[model samples]
Target: MPLLKVVYLSNNTKLYLWKITEDFDMLFSQVKLKDSSLARLESMKSESHQKGFLAVRMLLQHNDYSDFDLFYDEFGKPHLKPQGCSIKDVEISISHSNDFSAIAISDSKVGLDFERLKEKTLRIAPRYMDVSHLKNLSEQEKIKKATVVWGIKESIFKIKNEEGISFLNHIFEEDFSFEDKKATAKLIFNNKEEKFQIQFDSVEDYIFVCAFEDVK
Candidate 1:
């Protein structure tokens, strides 16, 4: 079985996304999922990894590269071929749900994350969201909006590679509204500042979160 949708995120940024609609068994044969990572996943308990693999393979379908040939870094980060360099410097992140798995690829550095976006919202809400963000939310804006904020924070974290960053401290959405499908976030790395564009989307009941940057 093959996934139903592929999203092209950046024409300039070299980013692509795919949504999986296939089962794990069929998903494996379609792309080259290099190394023991595929085998190791079987021993792990990550539903996200399983679904993410399917989502990522869907993107590989359009590229010239094979899954068996692709590999990650010492940090377990994906190493993609760079454009015009005889290699495509495409970085990726993948996520999955019961129904859909989301994949994101980029020419520049990119990061992505996905979660169920429920009960966990309350516990982490105050940790990352600032007072201004909280004040803007309606009493009814608890779950969905809160989760989006968390998604934004996670997206930024994916780029920074840091842990223990608080939504209340390190980052915040610039002009976010849960009603909209998109949000932009700001990140501070040393004295340099970066902006992240986030889009919250769903395939069936699953949430797909994406984040990216273009660096010189």
Candidate 2:
């Protein structure tokens, strides 16, 4: 499968998704990886993790990019080098869960997260989010909502890429209904408060979330 979906969140930001249906060898042979990435791939202990990594490369190739053009910072945030003569820097975020891999490219700082819907996430919701938000929801809805909240905090953390930002302590998501398919959240850390615009939806049994820093 090429791309599960392509979403244009704005004129400058786009999201690419891939459903991991191919086996490890199929994905590995479809894209080329740099030496560092190859070594990292070999070091991975799980086949699922390797498949997710290669699926991301597949998404990159779909956008006319290769692994050579991608690099990671010391904090392990993925970034794309200036493509050709373009002077504008492109920001990118990558995430994958059990059955999906997703990448978000934006003209501004962005973060992405993909999580599978499961009771385990909801079971520990109190550790990372406000359980009160889950009140009055059916069991199935609770699982979905909790997973989205987890993704929200994760996406926000990916954007900040700063230390000591605890999901339970610093990140807070405003109450949002599943029907809205969008919401807002805030990060309160180091005496600084920053807001983010959240856009999310469920794909199959998984939830994908993208976070953009609210500059306004």
Candidate 3:
């Protein structure tokens, strides 16, 4: 599928999602990749991973950018090179899980995470999340909510991209109702506190979460 959905997460930020229904060859043929990206793609052992990588490029092309414009930092965070001396840099975040690939672009720093629905997320909820939040939900609801919480932590971690930021110990998600589709979290690490605004939703058995650094 081409560009499954576009989410306007905020006035300055937008999320683009791609459902990876195309075959590897089809996706590979569609996007023009930088030599480094081609080398990295050749290094990937799994077809699924390669496809996810290509689909991200496809999304970039959908938005008028290409792989040549994207790069990574020493911390492994993705960054966009300014198109020209006149164009300002935009914050970008990318994630892929199962059959979906997603990217978020914003004027401010942003983080995005995509997770497939699975029993493991619920089983391991106690390890990283407050299991108390799962108490009143059914088995399926537990899975969905736990997956969201996991994405919340992952999204925040992507934004901070700092060493020793343990999801269980440092990232704290506040109480939120499933119906709200939004929440808040705090990163209490290294004796510094930072706040983030969280937004999440489910898409075809997958969960998409986005975190934006709170402006005070």
TM-score of each: 0.74, 0.97, 0.97
Regions of candidate 3 where Cα sits further than 4 Å from its true position: 84-87
**Candidate 1 displacement at residue 215 in angstroms:** 6.0
Task: Report lDDT per candidate.
Answer: 0.63, 0.93, 0.92
RMSD of 3: 1.1
Better of 1 and 2 by lDDT: 2
Give the TM-score ranking, best first.
2, 3, 1
Q: RMSD of candidate 2 to the true fold? A: 0.9
Residue 209: error of model 2 in Å? 0.7
Write model 2 residue lDDT over 41-157, tens digit each, in one string.
999999999999999999999999999989888998989988888897689999988878999998899999989889999999989999999999999999999999999999999
Task: Give the 10-residue window scoring lowest on summed lDDT in candidate 3.
Answer: 81-90
lDDT of 3 at 26: 99
Please state the error at residue 87 of candidate 2 in Å: 2.0
Model 3 per-residue lDDT tens digits across residues 107-154: 899999999999999988878988898888899999999999999999
Query: What lDDT, from 0 to 1, does candidate 2 have?
Result: 0.93
Runs of candidate 2 with Cα error greater than 4 angstroms are none
Model 3 has an lDDT value of 0.92
